[model samples]
Target: MASSTTRPDVETAAPSARVAGRLLDSSAKLSYDPLTEVDWETPLDTDFHGASPEWSTLYGTSYWDELTEAQRKELTRHEAASVASTGIWFEMILQQLILRDVYAKDPGDDAVQWALTEIADECRHSIMFARGAKKLGAPAYRPRRVAVELGRAFKTLAFGEAAYAAILVAEEVLDVMQRDWMRDERVVPFVRTINNIHVVEESRHMKFARDETRKNLAKAGPVRRHIHAFVIAVAAYVIVTSMVNKGVYANAGLDPERALAAARSNEHHKAMMRSSCSGLMDFLASARLLTKPALAFYKRAHLI
Candidate 1:
């Protein structure tokens, strides 16, 4: 009787174990040490934009048109730094969530091992972002006070699908933008290198998050699904809004009041977000996490 039960348990765990094993192998084959991979010694080049100009928050605004080429480059550099800072914040949250998730689990399990591996990646990523921001000559751009408090609560209390789904949302959103910037010749070399590293490593993390989300949701009831859906949506909203800090405008020598107003109503920026995030929205819909309430939040965030 004991052998029969144990056999069934092992069979049920096979798929995720295989996925985790593959991820481990992939990391071993092609992982980056950002400290070495990035050109940290090179001074910031003012001639190149920090990101693709099309990904800028004020890209199509009248204010954008009015800026000189140098001003536009400055703005984009600050914007990119702000985005990297926000990535650090979200990565920290996900790291805590993952650690709490695997706590006391079987150390030998491939999934738990993979979880630890991912945490290590995030630790390196946070340090990389901090150094990159300093190189760009930007101040530490933290999320708003409300967002900080909310993230603290969510990271502490969220579990299973809520935690994994939220992690997926943040990764997916950043993935789209980074993919563009990494390939654009107009972007600075070092920043492009940073994006390339992030894009490669985060692909694996996104895959794990997607698999864990579906696995966890399969065990959830309708009520729990609905609750988690809303929680994940709120988390997405906060993450999206916090990406480019308002302080970036001032740092870039733009009038904060005018830049903020223009950015808030930038139709081009909204369209870019919606188009870029279509794949993520489809994944959420397929997983049945795109409930009406969730859709509303996504729309408000311009991610739908």
Candidate 2:
């Protein structure tokens, strides 16, 4: 997170304690261990997709129409693996941002304890996603270099609502996409289990993020709030763009340049993002973070 002076949300106690207590108790009762819980022993099923087909970046492109069923399945599998890899990257950033947010605070406090718990969950989740991608037969996928560098800086410097709201946006985007894959029968069983675990565990994280964003904004002055809002939007844009690595198309055996072009012009995929993130947009609007400059970034990212 940024300098300690910028983090007013951590200085509070009553509301933070209530939220953190519930989260900690809930996690104890319902959290999963992906190592034992996921059905990883089964052979990879070529008949199934790694995620819902509609979530694929090239789902409605002309190239999609040209692909055979096997080709389409292969593409979605690579796409899913790419998404999982991106999840791992973002989770790493989130863990660091959060750990920084709680640094030197009261370790015994429920809020700090819950932050630690959330970090543990993300650690397990990154492992699960890595295993899932390997099982799907995709090579390691990483975000673009620019995104990688920006994430390093953001995790190191972002504080208050900027960090929390960016966290919320990433969680909400993954939550919606994973919800579909978890429930879709066409998705591989092991991958479905991974998505299910993430969706469930991240629910508490999202709740905490939303609460923290509001609390931070409550203390922020007009100038600071406006600045963080734009920063949050830029972070969201980078995250959204980085979700699918460019290597996926080529790894899936498609023409890399052509597939990339098609995916870029994919109105259907953009519409899906906009539709899925409606509630997230509502939350940002309610928080008054959707300023004109911020909304421009959101629109350019097709997350409006």
The whole-model lDDT of each prediction reads 0.93, 0.93
| Candidate 2 stretches greater than 4 Å from native | 1-13
Checking candidate 1 for backbone clashes, the offending pairs are none
User: Which tens-of-lDDT digit does each residue in 170-283 have in candidate 2?
Assistant: 999999999999999999899999999999999999999999999999999999999999999999999999989888888889999999999999999999999989999999
Q: Pull out the clashing pairs in model 2.
A: none
Off by over 4 Å in 1: 1-13
Worst 10 residues of 1 by lDDT: 1-10
* Best candidate (score: lDDT): 1
Score every model by TM-score. Answer: 0.95, 0.95
lDDT of 1 by residue, 63-166 (tens): 99999999999999999999999999999999999999999999998899999999999999999889988988889999999999999999999999999999
